[model samples]
Target: MAFKSEYLAKVYASVEKRNPGEAEFLQAVKEVLTSLEPVVAARPDLVKAGVIDRIVEPERFIQFRVSWVDDNGNVQVNRGFRAQFNSAIGPYKGGLRLHPSVCASVIKFLGFEQIFKNSLTGLPMGGGKGGSDFDPKGKSDGEIMRFCQSFMTELCKHIGADTDVPAGDIGVGGREIGFMFGQYKRLRNEFTGVLTGKGLTYGGSLARTEATGYGLCYFTSEMLKCMKNESFKGKTVVISGSGNVAIYATQKATELGGKVVALSDSNGYIYDKNGINLDVVKQIKEVERARISEYAKRVPGSEYHEGCRGIWSIKCDIALPCATQNELNGDEAQMLVKNGVIAVAEGANMPSTPEAVEVFQKNGVMFGPAKAANAGGVATSGLEMSQNSIRYSWTFEEVDKKLNDIMVNIFHSSYDASKKFGSEGDLVMGANIAGFLKVADAMLAQGIAY
Candidate 1:
């Protein structure tokens, strides 16, 4: 949607002009601003206070050099970034991604989305994100440790327990978080919960690993129930990506009586006619860390396709794109709608293109945006932060219960916002508006300090 409000168009134009060659960042900005066309008209004070402009821009964009030595004793250098986008509600809370695709645009877009995602959780977590372009794949433990340490050397200067709390994202996991946390502890000389996805022995919260995926299922189930008067029970599901989010989503979905038929990775996807074996996928992805193709090899009657995009072609009642950004496009969305897909929820940041979302919403498919849907991981991270501050840990069941409650509440919040904003059942606009109002109002109340 083109911006209807002049203020919104101007704000987006400024963002596009300021961040040239940043396709991902621009896309994120446009989506949020487009949703806020109603809000921009409803709250002129927000526009006058420059809240939209401030929200579009980061509070601090930190870029640094990380130099590490490879196993071959060759010095390697990678760029590390931190975009502290907002801190109106609380400290900077987001994840640090470590992938070769980690660039200014990706980090900025992730950070931008984090602002609202953290807000929608109703937790005092402002938005911030950081990462390095150094791919951790195929690297030995020692090599990864060195790279993480080097990355944290500069990052440690800008983060703290109450300042900026970082977690894991794509190409980042417990192992990487462990190395970075260890380095932060050594350098800062104080053991703090500056990072969320930590080792359990140190400060990690139980269920944090499974939080995002479980949370996604919780939200999806709620959306299905509220809008369609249905549940995941007996639904054919197709989930893209076999990483943490995909793995846990499959587990929870199956437990909820949904048959997940397909799972994928960057290289290819696997289709299991009967149902996906979560154990095999976990073994291939989490334990052995091998390609998802291994699942087809080990599990009989499963077919493996050589392209990841083909996973969306599988017929299903529900679709969860847990893969990276824009992995599902407009055409795939059209295909899903044609296949009788009733609901589509995102498990990754901005996984669906704008066109794809239009396709879903127009076709009457229940759409759950990422900030509201995939907030479980960050929501659990917020719980972990609380536990850290008090030096206490909750049981797995306790945390899981809280996670489910949070996800349910987030769904209603988005749903209510959609209804209030006159976009009944349109969670895309609802989530964006619902997430934006809290921060924007807070920014207004704080006396235009941006």
Candidate 2:
């Protein structure tokens, strides 16, 4: 177990007292704080400067109401949120997820994790996140456009190119980003890159769409090589979530000679005895926007399970949880270990619960923390910001090369940090300590105003 210094524990207690019922936010805070005992013990100045106390709190939090009209001539109202958790290093950078589950606690947890994830990228991007409780699944194109415009009407005032820059998350994709970006450009009358994950016709950079998923595989491969003397070649992989992350992860793993056997969505999971058909998945998801069950129906020799969690039961050498937070619990972790799983990497934000992480660590499963493994998206977003600043764009090959190098560096740094802090081979503590030290130093040098 990771140790928590007395000072760190006290600061976390204060956070819990101040923000009751915010389980997601509290969980994120506790995870990061618990891994910082060595830092506090070695450098008393961090506690003296109140870095932990200030870093745990967001610099600014804004909530607003978004009102739009549906196709049925009904006025729809949704709650919107933007939590600028920390800007100690650079401008705020994160994603905006438009789902029914978008609440303050979820947004804050993501924003808080963004702080460390951005730091690990070695990029000048601070942590921030914004989204709404607007479900875009069943909405028409016109309805989604109206809601995005309305959401940006208030969001634009709080964000800018040099300020907080938002990107796409769960429900906010290229289409949604295009809608919001157009609104931002119309209202501000500036063609700056205020939002990332934009279409190529705009200021978007290449390889941004595949960054997160590809990066997960890259980071995971590095961990396997360094820690286990293994690689992805000839390995079997199970990825949850059929979204951008899972799709690209499956693509990269297949390209690397690994057989991805299963993928899941909200409805259920599909297991292909042979390697999954990427073309079929792309057709069903990207082209048709249908469910995973559609893939099972379209492709022969495939079985579709009724529950999404059952995807974890399929035997595999690697498991990537790209679905959602807490999707993998302790029981799932134990089952994977019992089934001879060797590695577990999170493609989503905090997909593994504390108990699940403990199980993996105790059972010798190579665990890649979400903040380190899933950082490729934000790292490319930072590159996109640079391109926007220079009015230049890099080709897909160039951007992908840079992203791969970044992921490799992140893995090495985390490994070295873990070894340095006496938690050798524990990437969770290594990532937390490495990311925390960077932000903490920046905050200390910048003083308390941050």
Candidate 3:
């Protein structure tokens, strides 16, 4: 696609020509830049001042080697990366994913998305993300611990409560966060909210684990109320990914009077004619660490379907893509629209493709971009930082109430940003503009670092 802004086109072309084989990172930059064309065009000072160029690139990119001894005394070496993409609003804040899929491109995409997501939260946080190609799915506890320790040995140098705070993503959950924080404390000899998503015994905030999932539904409900004059009451929801986000999204939606019909993982999906029993689902994923297919076996009436892609083919009133990026392509989006899926709120980062998003917008489906819909996790992370600074924790209800307000405020901010930017109903445009303006202004104020 051709860019309307010549400056953005030049930047994209320069990035592509200078860095060969960076397709993933370039694609992420293009998606964001496309949305920002109008914003940059209207505010020529941003482009003239080189704010677009700086925003496209990271402030600092750290790459290090992590060597850890496994339980069997075998040394495993993996790469660790922290892309402190931007720290304009405040410190660099994002998650540390530990999937085998982790790379500079993947981290860039996530961090780029995080910038807007954090902005929507009305929190003082910029965007950044880090992780490794190390897969933790089948690893033992000791092995996971060793890997995290090794990873943190290098990471601790670049991060802090007020500098860059990392949280959990795909593989970096409670267990991973604990191990990483332990290493950081041991090395630095200081206790702080250098990371979010810690175990409750530590500095982690209450309701932090369920914040993203619950927040997604909260934003979705508000969108429904405003657009369709409806709520989650008596609605059927289909969610993908049985991980923290998906599981909790199901729980919150159900609690709000919606019935979750389906949930899936990388392995497959389980469809229950009745609402999925959240307890059983949580037990399987959280305790046993089993595939989602086991949910059907636990319940006699449920059907287990192999392959994650097929979950979208199921019929439902609302759809939450809680899995990975680009999971819902144009074809699956068409399927959802045809199957009477009235609303689509992204629980994962950039789960929908540009084509899929276009289809949803054209069809008038109430679309919530991941930045606006999934800001709950990071917003709560910021709250955790607050607690750490003050040396106190809020009750679960208190944290949840704050999360609810933040999600609602994010909805309003994005909605208002969309209208102001002349794309009233286009959330993609709204999120990018709302997020970019703050970062751009900050970058402009900070000026170029020589």
- After superposition, the stretches of candidate 1 with alpha carbons farther than 4 Å from their true spots are none
Return the TM-score for each candidate structure.
0.99, 0.99, 0.98
> What CA RMSD would you report for each candidate?
0.7, 1.0, 1.2
Residue-level lDDT of model 2, residues 1-450, one tens digit each, is 334467877898898898899999999999988888788888899989999999999999999999999999999999999999998889999999999999999999999999999999999999999899999998999999999999999999999989999999999999999999999999999999899998998999999999999999999999999999999999999999999999999999998889999999988999998989999999999989999899888889999999899988999999999999999999999999999999999999999999999999999999999999999999999999999999999999999999999999999989999999999999999999999999999999997766
Ranking by lDDT: 2, 1, 3
Clashing pairs in 2: none
Report residue 17 deviation for candidate 3 (angstroms). 2.6
Task: Rank candidates by TM-score, best first.
Answer: 1, 2, 3
lDDT of each: 0.94, 0.94, 0.90
- Residue pairs that clash (backbone atoms under 3 angstroms), model 3: none
Model 1 C-alpha lDDT per residue in residues 99-209, reported as the tens digit of each score: 999999999999999999999999999999989899988999999999999999999999998899999999889999999999999998999999999989999999999
TM-score of candidate 1 against the unseen true structure? 0.99
Comparing 1 and 3 by lDDT, which wins? 1
Q: Which ten residues in a row have the lowest lDDT in candidate 2?
A: 1-10
lDDT of 3 by residue, 237-303 (tens): 9999999999999989998899999999988889998889989998999999988888887898999
